[model samples]
Target: MSDANGGFRPRLRALDRRQGLAFMAALAERLRPNYLLYAEASEQGDPAALRVIHDLIWEALLVKEARIDFERQAEKLAEMEPPAEDESFGARRALEAVMALAACLDSLRGEAPEAALEVSELSRSGVQAFIELTEGEEDAQRLAALIRQHPLMDDEYDFQAAVLEAVEAPLDRGALKELRRLGRNGGVSNLGLTLD
Candidate 1:
């Protein structure tokens, strides 16, 4: 389902029993450890930790919901009959949407906020490139020409590898540490200067 702004709203009620069970399993897998820690923090009355855990749970839920949507769309597309000439473009558009959702879920897998944002940006550009690739293919001849011109279209390795490579890379803790150091050292202007 979509909201008034066209943003996705999870079709929680639309899910069948199997899909609902799968969603629940994935959600629990992602949140169980955090829930344990959240419980510990709550017992100690640590508001800050409690807040972080709450945010983590919310983020996980959003990611899981998106995964279900992507899977559902892909299944629906698979069950579709062969597209007529006019309907072909809709198939391509659906592919792009599924790609975007995959990118989002991939980004969120590790619970890394920055990586999720990066993957979202990269995925959007990837889909835009796909759109541009077919923009001038108004006929079979043009599409054939496009395929010949861009052989890499047959290969998805580059983008998929990039996304996974980036997700696997460790977060830069040094940057956060440097920011804290700067804060202690009296802000940006004093970053590299000696005050002796």
Candidate 2:
């Protein structure tokens, strides 16, 4: 279920640097499958590269001394964004995944303090777009209401809440690993896309 104000932005805003990075990493892990499917279909981007970036983010979270070249990683991630002209729903979802990862990288670089909040909004927007595309609802008012009640959207809201709750605690390697698994959501995305 969605909050009336949209999402847990306030809670995300309160997170410390490490907690914020953890939050972004988990949500990006959940959305990675969307990019994987798109890359497989279009043969344009490298899913492996994206996976490497995600792994780096997780490592930074779990290992205090983990060294990552955030600038280079961000450059690589920029290459993954689908062309703006590609208006297909899959492309949109793929872009969301890429952008979410970008936000994670930005957080790691200490560039965007609100990266977690940005990822939260991206996750919810991806769900809303999926609902719009699949349900074929044209009216703005109806679509807004439908998004609130839709199971997929509910899953998104619930998943974000869970991730936020999980990241609030002190995290170690094991805890971060568990958070990654939880974000995977049993291999399904907010858009219900599965990794092949």
Candidate 3:
């Protein structure tokens, strides 16, 4: 199950619907703090609103009887998108977080069959952007090389692989909770940011 050249999508497609949704939800959960941090700093967007949608995703996976209004959730998620004109790195990362969550919701609604892969790529892109911003390297080729070799990027790939492995196996409520815990990564984001 290599992630090379978007190879993981076919593997994701092999999973059952619930498994795929679980995979996306886990990645989205990991990304939640990125948006929350941005929202807090910018004093825009409702952090609690985003949290509600994330909570709903986990609940839906954990409880068989739980139901989510995907369309309404998508509408709510759209409102959280950062303005395109705000091109700060934080804004970009926050936007990716929102989009990843939206992809998760879309997958649940059967609108985005590749939601898991999209979330995976978004997470990696966020890490790459962070590395490029912090490294301060103007050379595109060197920066690209650095990003491929960075520890954060390695962790991102490893984390996604672990999540996929978890979902590929049999899952129950307890396993799902464990997966969420793994995604949480002890209150850390993919870029190693922690919510204060």
Candidate 4:
């Protein structure tokens, strides 16, 4: 089906199915920018962030589905034991982090926003490069060293401060007053808001 802009859209059913390994790999490369955009939007508190969030979730889930299909195919065709789960990949922790991010979004949208959002470094480029390096070399030890060197696992970024910083840059006198009004109406979060 084509959208109003005449772009051909994939059918819903087609999108719902598990993609092949090759297809998933291609899609991941294509959609990675969307993940980066999502991060930017999140930091900016852009209302469009929700749409990007949905795309990120869909893309990540499809990758997971492809992996499951590949595992099943390998077991059936090769008559070999299924590949062992690699805890070093930290897939579960990554999912948890995403879930936490979603929850933070919800909290921000609620009447009583949280005082602060604790977030880890969400460097999409770093993650993609790490995946490529690990997959290419098939070396978990090397991946661990990279992770340690890059400090990719650290939750050092502050979400609320980022959002405020992004939004404040373009605020004029009127917008600044409006922001102050809203800030007064809604108690500030423990997340420090610096007005320069």
Q: TM-score of every model?
A: 0.23, 0.93, 0.92, 0.24
Q: What is the lDDT of residue 189 in candidate 4?
A: 17
Clashes of each: 0, 0, 0, 0
Could you give candidate 2's per-residue lDDT for residues 80-111 as a string of tens digits? 89888998888888988899889888877789
Ordered from best to worst TM-score, the candidate numbers read 2, 3, 4, 1
Location of the lowest summed lDDT over 10 successive residues in candidate 1: 187-196
Which residue pairs show collisions in model 1? none
Kindly give the stretch of ten consecutive residues in candidate 3 with the minimal lDDT sum. Answer: 1-10
The digit string of per-residue lDDT tens for model 1 on 85-130 reads 4234333333332333333343334332343333333333443455
**Candidates sorted by lDDT, best first:** 3, 2, 1, 4
User: Which model is ahead, 1 or 2, in terms of TM-score?
Assistant: 2
- After superposition, the stretches of candidate 1 with alpha carbons farther than 4 Å from their true spots are 1-58, 61-86, 99-156, 171-196
* Index of the highest-TM-score prediction: 2
Q: Judged by lDDT against the true structure, how good is candidate 1?
A: 0.33
Model 4: per-residue lDDT, tens digit, 67-94? 2232332223222111235233333222
lDDT of candidate model 2 versus the reference: 0.85
- lDDT per residue as tens, model 3, 1-196: 2458356677877887789889888888788788888898998778899989989988888887887788999998899888888998889989988988888788778788777777888898899989988999999999988988899998998888889889988889889989999988888999999987
lDDT of each: 0.33, 0.85, 0.86, 0.31
